[model samples]
Target: MAFQEETLNLQMKYFVLVKPSNSTPSCILSLSTIDNRDIYNNLCQTVHVYRSSPIHDSDSSFDIFHVLKEALSKALCYYYPLAGKLVESADDGKRRVHCNPNAENYGVPFLEATANCTLSSLHYLDNNDLEIAKYLVFDPQDKSYPLVFKVTKFLCGGFTIGMGVLHAVCDGFGASQFLKSIVELSRGRTEPSVIPVWERERLVGSITKQPFPKSPMNNVAFSPFLNETSSTVIKKYCFKVEGEMIRRLKMSLRKENENLGFTTFEALAGFVWRSRARALKLNNNGETMLSVLVGMRRNLKDFEPLPKGYYGNSCVDANLVLKVSELNERPLYEIVKLIKETKNVGSTSEYVKNSIDTWETNGKESLKMKSGGAVTVLTEWRHLGFLNENVEFGGNEVVNVVPAPCNLFASVDMSIFTSSNKFDDENDPSMKGGVNLFTSLPVDAMPRFKEEIESLRFLS
Candidate 1:
């Protein structure tokens, strides 16, 4: 519906106590599969402790609707695709709207149409707890976004917010852009401090601009609402993984692969994806692919955080090749080696930016990928500054924050976000690594996956 309702004298709040900037701050965020209403409600509460607004001099200025709207707008700004400049179809006339010109104010009807298509799942909200209710305050309504955000009016004179943005939009670093922006906007700011740049053409336009990639955005091969109906039902579960555990895991893998040291993410992802592969027990010695999202922040050379600082999906996803059996049975270090080698070729932020063009010009179909095809994504967002426990709203607390699982067919998808439990070397372990997993296989998949993991236990 409306970004935020104005009736009932509604108001907005922030997790961070930022002053209303004259400009919109480019705050950002991302999510994992968190359909439970109670937890979602709790996340909506501002986790940051805010002092009395010196400017407001009174609480009258706080508008929940506006606050939530600010958050939604920034999130939207980050991944709206209106900003991406590649054309997937040719003059062959697939006759559809393409990404390159990110601005789509006229697509309001299209957004609403897509938004309305998701009415069926809305019932998931009817059963949420208060934590979930509060969480909905800033959630997004676009179903494509793994995160779900919605708005509901209350009889008492207010409304509820909902969001379910897919982690694909941007990772935690990107998400922070929106959060920062909303906080600034709520303070009554006008434009954003660091306006996000969606010039994908400049950053990563296709190598072949005349034609587009095979349109992953509009694949008829996959159904619009990718319900796991035909697949065996898989129950959802989550746990906080210690960063120390992750750090040690990386070190151990590195010791094994001294010549090709693996990053914490590669080691951990390789370990997990392989475990899941073993559980599948497929006969084919197929080539398994591990997808890692590469952030193009300042072209990877590590520029001072963009004067705009970590905004949107400045990422290029790449795959690592391994035998399915290797993924499941090989020493973690070997997998780490493979990951490092693949990444070593072109980690310059430059390649990440150029990939946009290469991908756009070459199209995904033209780029050959080795066949044995079991693709899994491996990434670590802990290093991205999401570890800061600066989220809160008024009296409410953000007990948790996670990105929903990306629904990929016949593919095992796993996303690991910075855990809320701190695990900084200096600070107490409040934030750890939280894993979000997804698959279209059977319900038996996960338990079996866990068993396969234990099969590779690294003995002391």
Candidate 2:
């Protein structure tokens, strides 16, 4: 939690503006309504870790900074919007990318930094403490740029690449695609495997003309505390849920009722949601909500598919509302089935279009979550290609991929990641085929929360 005994003594070496290698059209790109959410106004940071390579010690010919900077420039040729900065419209006050044709004005910030200690001394950055981890990423007060990159080299030849991209520009999947492109270019590829597409207009379907009903998203508050200045302190904990436990849970559910198919996500999310409610000991009369961020790429393919390389904020949060007593009373299978059904209904083309139309008609305020009630938001990142793709820079082995910590809402938020190559060891049975869950909850309830999760798994 304290970063370590040895001080990082990290110092900034230099900051350079990396522009696109080839000229791209200069125009103001209007972000889709889905991308204009107020919650996505800030940067979403992710740090990519790489261990020491032979090139770091013996090969003077290979320079990490030089290779990555050049690759970034080439990647920018395809992802030019990232080189541009976000600007507000004069009329609607909505944010949009302003691509300055002048190469001098539009460029992504590439920062170089150095740490006095080795990455292993920092435990390969497996900790969830933001106070220590924030140093590795670049998060500035002015978040106008669509993208920013920072590479910090350690004394032992290891390094971490910190990427900060505006969430409105893309979702986790889209960002992963951009990262793959950079990795490809850095590895001496002339072109990326997937071409980039920028057609935000396609997300804007026909506006809804019918009278809108009360949406469940309105009741799904992300935080129980309304004021950020409250004295409540929330802490984050990362737990590895073994594949055996997940399989057993699913098997138990099937034994009860074999009619429905249970996914790992549905089973785990249901368990965590129920576990949190029980741990918190919420009043039975009160309501609890579960919101899951569902990727709409496959759903859109059913009706008017987006381009192959189309990467934007193509995700919608599906909400499930239930009374606190009902959540505790219902069996795990019922909860899992409910979650599956919610996802099934939300993943349709009609639902996506209707969501878009609602946002377009009523604006972001319509989707704004109200304060009060217990809410837990779950998002699955295993299949997002961050671990599956070749995101390696200059053949460096990726050690870890982590979301940089930020001050978010007071409610519980869970990010699930499957076993990565870093932990995929044939000898280490405990580390294989399992999912790592990153959970943030109030510091007071964390002990009980862990107990509840363990009890559920063991009882199942």
Candidate 3:
């Protein structure tokens, strides 16, 4: 595919402050767990596009902006913490949500804009054009707000919704729940089906002081705040892996190890891990790591499973490290085994409980995991329901979902987000019920990485 320059005449139309419709008490909401502080600097932004609704008359009487604004206001009543601002606590110097029910600081930042292009025009945008899409979303540098929203209307009547939520406020799953509620309200629903729960302190419980576990991968000394320089340029790539190909890969692995019952996620991640190590040309003895984000909501044994509406960070990072030569020479099944074992260690209910206990006792200063060296962070967002949310604007449901660029974070060697294919051709084997990998790599190594990924298709 050839890269084409596409211009989007995007202009900010208006800024709406979405406040809660019902009154609530004023107080500060403390982030109960230290895990919330881990992603204080990361911006989780998502963009969804919908085709123009056919219900509008020839006069274009359907006003989407007004409807969305009103619906969002109603949704804020239940998910009121989203309408609050992030402020530093004077005592602990930690950030917490200041939910002043008072009129001054109790509204979410919502921006409305228009563009000259249609949803089809966005087809020209590839992995490299993610910066353009990121600009369409609201990103606050000062960390003043927990949530910011942007809506862009196209000339062809299609529109795109861009959301930028601080990771400290909620993970992707939590954000989806909030968005679904907004959709329901937009469709004229009286109230949200699920009420949000905010018992973070009780769910996490008290911290217990104990010796931190010793793990080489988690003991890295790198920090994102440090100034680092390198000749490698950061670039992004996107690829579609067919469901059939994934099945074949898993089958081959299972044949080698009868006990191997890996999901598509494990199979694909193994391939990427090996391929990336080869492409980077790291020293044989150098350490290469793969970090996976494991959710703790369902894995908590001590506490009941988090409620459907618990909008907070409840994920723990698990890391698997191996010598570069071992990764390259090992069979694919072996790599899959390593990935599975790491997941098992992280997915255990006890592991999550211990993590919370440790973090609570030591606070943010005790976080040991650091991103640097040859580490690649993989986040699986396939089940987040980005496409199935039924988010309708002007009677049109969301047709496409595009994640923001991963190139902004330079400290990490690579960042990968995997999602189900949104645009697949009927005849294309690689596109049928497949997975799409949105990845970022150092520019100097991307060419070699592309070669490795392409080789996997034939090898499978």
Candidate 4:
């Protein structure tokens, strides 16, 4: 009760500090929780997502602050862990993973630092400025997501919501749950048009139950051969990619061959693998490997869906191996076809088992090596976020989405998030979707990278 009072004071101070001015980036979200001592090590994952689409229909009316206030009030009513520092059995029956926050692998005692994931939507006179569409608050000054979201107000009146999500318990999906929950609370309608489910063990089972392997040799996640750079930089650029371009490449795949039979992701992922390989000059390279994350939820489709508001790493990796020259030499369609064949409907048990086998496998998996060819990874977080808009506040809705790339599992050299957005929403043409790209290279690489992107001839 006392902490609640303190939280209120913090909110008021923050609100006064971030008061809206014509130029200042305004505050759109603010809330706090008792800093759970066992948070960081206990947390399962941390991710920030953004969604934007042009507002098509008009109803230039909203009670943005009133809606957001109600939403936060409800989120505060339910105190939950951001990340579940877990300890459990390897076998099935929906058990927690055997983990120790203090253990070497897990690094026990999840941190309790308050975190935040801020989502601010800046308005433009025209849609030409898509590049600077959504500026997310990454690398928070608080060093956490929840802390950044201490105050909430809709900026530019009603078009966007800034969110600072805590990382200790939820991943992006969990954040969506909070959003949806708030939406329901604001409507004075407790019957969540869709309710959140939070049974962790049932969501993402133990690694022991479903293993995915991580090798040493080809994996770029941990290798000494990285270009001379800081560890922090390495972590960030671990996997830098262009989502819209990827979509374009994938759409090309579909247009080229109707029966090629592969998800756009599978097709273009191969192309990206080849592109990175070519860029890095690793063609015809020796044992080239890429691993893709597979969510066990669909694999276990026979079972009930994982609980809503579930925040755990619910997926594992699939090994994609190829000779770099062989991959590069083949037509894009052929490479994608191969990717399709490699697909497997894996489950938690399979993921846990494969991880054990792969960790024991002869080489490094997550490590990105100058010696190895390019690697391609996949994630369904973006795909799943399609429903985020279902959770809304007043007239505001989450329509488009972007996922932040963070150091995950200490294995992947390149972590890819499939940013999903629906462009046809006529009512909210105000939203435009684009990927929020993060890289591990020095800040200097950004200028050059931008130059390269600008220099690219899309027509050519």
Candidate 5:
């Protein structure tokens, strides 16, 4: 199939306000302190692309919009909080959801659109043209609604389901649960497999309002917000690290410490961090940091596990700080060990509680990065289940899933995605295993970044 090199034109048809089929309670849902962080003050958008199957093409009377709208209504009946309004408290700046019973006031925005080109032309949304993203997702100017969706059909009969959800409402895991509810209903399921539990109070019950000291090592920093004033142009690039390469990297790391077994994330994130630091050519004496989200849902030494259906911002920040010289000079295995240790510490019950308390007390102002340090934020979406096989449209599973071009996370230094044969040609071995890495860097620095990562291909 010939792919189009230019951006495809999209026409927005109409928008519908979708509400829950069943009535829900009218109340205010309080957001956890973690959810009120400055970092999550924006929207998170993603697109799930589905190809035209024989069944969809053969049925002339089938309307994708109608099917989805019905499923959405069903989904909202269960996860009604998502269909509510995101409002702010007048007394304090904290955000909460006001679940108004009226449909006109609480409905989520749903849009219908059509694209001039086929999914193949856009390389299943793998193209570099960021312009294509504008039409794929609906971005509301105000935070009135907690969620917004757009369903764009391609000329070739393929369609993409795009969503924009307020990050403060839920983390990736929570969003995935809500998405699964819709998918299950769309597939004729009466209800979602896992019932959602609203337990924000459980996570934030213990509040110690005290200021915490800053990291003694000036080398460590939280990932910085985008530098709008910088003259350098940033470009996004996608690279694939084959499964064999990852195995080799992990094997090599294991040789350093036979007892220390490194998972794919530990080894890969460490490798990317080192590669980025080297590519940027930072001063050896300067500090470079790797920031990652550590999941806090598991059973800790002193804390019970969070309920299975409890989907909130149950994650803590974990940063691995190192001197540039040490990072570049140390063996890859040692760096992987450091990554593993950072995660271990960050996942502990005491550490998680302290981090939450510190964030709650310090407020958003204290969430700034140091003035003179390079930071890379790594988010693992491969295991997020955004592209689960069960999430199908018209009996066909989605072929590709991509974050909206406007996503703030996309502006970060690096993001990792699941590798799937479905994303590309099934015959292609490279897409079947390993992970896909999306990287953003200064235009001039990308080539060096690519070079640094490319060396991993021959690690074995």
Candidate 6:
């Protein structure tokens, strides 16, 4: 299929300040204990792209911009913190949400624009052309609003909604919940099904009187942003791994070792880790590490499952270290075992509680420390309800959803597995039920990495 590259002529229609319809009290909201403040300190934005179905002339009266603005106002009433601005705290010098109920700083910035090109014309675009995607959303460094949105109307009567939310306010899950509420309201729902909870203090309680021992994990420094020179060339690649291929890979691993039982995430992550290790060609003595974000909402034993409305950073980082030589020589099952074991440790409530306690005791100094060695970070975004929402902008359901790469954590190599859409053919290489891997690597290493990934299909 020939893909056309068309210029999108976007003209700003108007800037709307979406405030909560109901009044809210003024206050400052602090980061939760589990919130990795140091890592997300940069002014990076998480962009979500949604493509809408074609709008017919019969529905010309349906004004998408007005509907979104009204629904957003209602949604902000429930998720007021998002509507607030991020201001640095006087005492700690850390940024916190200043949630004032008045209209001044409490409204989110919403931009409505019209584009000359249709959404279909941009189907050829992918992660490699992220600039196009970035242009669809608000400025990443724009700190005026914690959440900003841009709706672009296409000439073909289709539209796209791009949302840019600061990483400091909430994680992807929290952001998705907030977006879902807006969609529900847009659909004429009286009330949002899931309310938002803002009790971050409960997650990260006050410090204890006695000094706690420093955690071993704090020994390494934590550098989330990479020092980029003019010569540094970072490129992103998106690859789709079908469910059949994933199942076969896991089956092969279990066949090699009868005791192995790895989930799709573990198996795929291990495959990517091993491939990268080989591509980088690290020395036998050198270490290769895999870091993953583990959610603690349902796993916390001390507290009941976090309320449906609970919206905060309720996750911790887990790592697996292995010698490069061992990683290359061992069977895939062994690597899967290592990943499974490491993730299991962080799966428990006790583990998450202890991690928070350690962070509280160590304070900012420990948080500033970067990891000792280079590690590859993998963030899984599957089943986060990005496409499941009933998002209608005067048309049918969302046709395509693309999550832009998070540039904040640009220090180490990063890979994100976003959800995929369905294709017609079951055996089609681009079939649905697959995961789209958005990855970044040095220009020199990417060729070898791509080769390694392509060889997965031949796995026996």
Model 3: residues with Cα > 4 Å off, grouped in runs: 1-6, 57-59, 124-129, 213-215, 218-229, 299-303, 368-370, 406-417, 425-429
Candidates 2 and 3: which is better by lDDT? 2
| TM-score ranking, best first | 5, 2, 3, 6, 1, 4
Every model's TM-score: 0.58, 0.91, 0.89, 0.57, 0.91, 0.87
Candidate 3 residue-wise lDDT, 1-460, digit = tens: 1122356677785566788888866878877674355544466777777777667635476766777788888988888888888777678766678888785656888888877777677762334336677666776545577788888788878777888777777777888888888988888889877778887775454657663454544333232222266556555567666667676777788888998878788888888877776666666766778878887767355556877778777777677888777888888899999898999888887777777676666665664444444677787787877777465554676766777663233344545555553456434566566787777666666677778766656654
By TM-score, the better pick of 4 and 5 is 5
Better of 2 and 3 by TM-score: 2
Q: Please tell me which predicted candidate would have the highest TM-score against the true structure.
A: 5
Candidate 1's displacement at residue 330, Å, is: 3.1
Candidate 6 wrong stretches, greater than 4 Å:
1-6, 42-57, 124-129, 140-144, 205-230, 367-373, 392-394, 423-430
Residues 347-379, candidate 2: write the lDDT tens digits.
887777777787777764565554343777888
Model 4 lDDT tens row, 1-460:
0112211111222231121111212112111111111222221233222232234124344434444554554443442222112232234211222222232332111111111222332322112222222222223333322323322222223233445444434455556666666567677865444444444334322224323432433533222223445342322432223444545565667677777767646754675555555444453545566666666445353455655444444444566677766766777788787766656534445444454344333122323334322454555455555445556444445544433333342333444544434432333332234333332333333344344333322412
Please give the RMSD of candidate 2 to the true structure: 3.1
Q: Give the whole-model CA lDDT for all candidates, comma-separated.
A: 0.40, 0.75, 0.70, 0.40, 0.76, 0.69
Clashes per candidate (backbone, < 3 Å): 98, 0, 0, 94, 0, 6
Q: Clashing pairs in model 5?
A: none
Q: Please, what are the lDDT tens digits per residue for candidate 6 over residues 1-460?
A: 1122347667775566788889876887887766536666544444444444545545676677787889999998888888888777668755678887765646888888887677667762433445476566665345647788887777766666778777667777887788888888887888888888887777774455543344333223222122323244566667777666776787789899998877889999999988766665545665667888898777455665777788777777777777667778998898899899989987877666666776676667543433322467888887677766454443555645665544656453677887775221233664455777777665666688778877767767
* Higher-scoring candidate on TM-score, 3 or 5: 5
